[model samples]
Target: MDWRLKRNCSMAPRQLLAFYLSLCILSLGIATMFWFQGARMIMTFAWIELFAVGLALWVVARHATDSESIVLRNDRLTVEVANGQQVERVEFQPAWVRVEPAHGDQSLIELSGQGRRIAVGRFVRPELRSQLAQELRHALRRWQQGAARPSPV
Candidate 1:
């Protein structure tokens, strides 16, 4: 068996920030041109341009949420989320950290080890992601506590 499971996800914050920064720089160029032309009509155009920029930011953030994937396998745990042209990957082993639910049965889960916690599945809805995190935690915790080694993945 291939033993690979893929979950579609989104990009990280740094990537989103970079994309937004670039967009703002481009929007500024357009705004500067309008100001230099002294076109009274540019005022109206500027507002529209601002709206367009806002829309672009929203698209990038929303797209970042959709164009992501979480891949789990035996040897390593990999999370792939994209923002703009950048792709981010986070990987670790079961023995390295602990996965615990952050909220109720319907909340996101917390992955922590050696004094750090990363809440995974931020893009997914609260309830379902919580359940998933719970299941994974329960399965992995047993192994960490010396119960039994889960078959890799």
Candidate 2:
């Protein structure tokens, strides 16, 4: 079983870059017209505004692909989280892992075992976080049960 959770982005980073470029063209074109009319401050302020918007967009683009992936296969359970340029990966045996919320019910779900812990479900809604936790617990339970059973020779 595998569960992938990611942000609901309205636009990809490439699309965002295209939109920013178009905005720059339009704003700069209008600013140039105002500059020709002797309002040179318009061009200066346009450049400043575009710079601010570009910086904000760059921050957004950096985290556009942030995600959490949980995979249960065989006797191992793996959790991988990617945020901006950082990635964290953890593995545990299905029988030893514990699934619970880190804080309150609405907080992120945490998986802990063997002196290691990781939180997940950031992209999930607060109201539905419990449901996500429940699902993870159910999957882990099934894996544990399967691991406990003997295989036929």
Whose TM-score is greatest here?
2
Residue-wise lDDT of candidate 1 within 40-118, one digit each (tens)? 5765676677678777666656554444454445545555556556666666676776766777656656666655455
Per-prediction TM-score: 0.46, 0.93
Measured over all alpha carbons after superposition, the RMSD of each candidate to the real structure, in angstroms, is 8.3, 2.2
List the global CA lDDT of all models.
Answer: 0.60, 0.93
Error in Å for residue 34 of model 2: 1.3
Q: Assess the local accuracy of residue 15 in candidate 1 as a C-alpha lDDT between 0 and 100.
A: 72
Clashing pairs in 1: 9-68, 73-153, 74-152, 74-153
CA lDDT, candidate 2, residue 124: 96
Q: Considering summed lDDT, which 10 consecutive residues are worst modelled in model 2?
A: 143-152
Residue runs of model 1 more than 4 Å from their true location after superposition: 1-68, 102-107, 114-117, 138-153
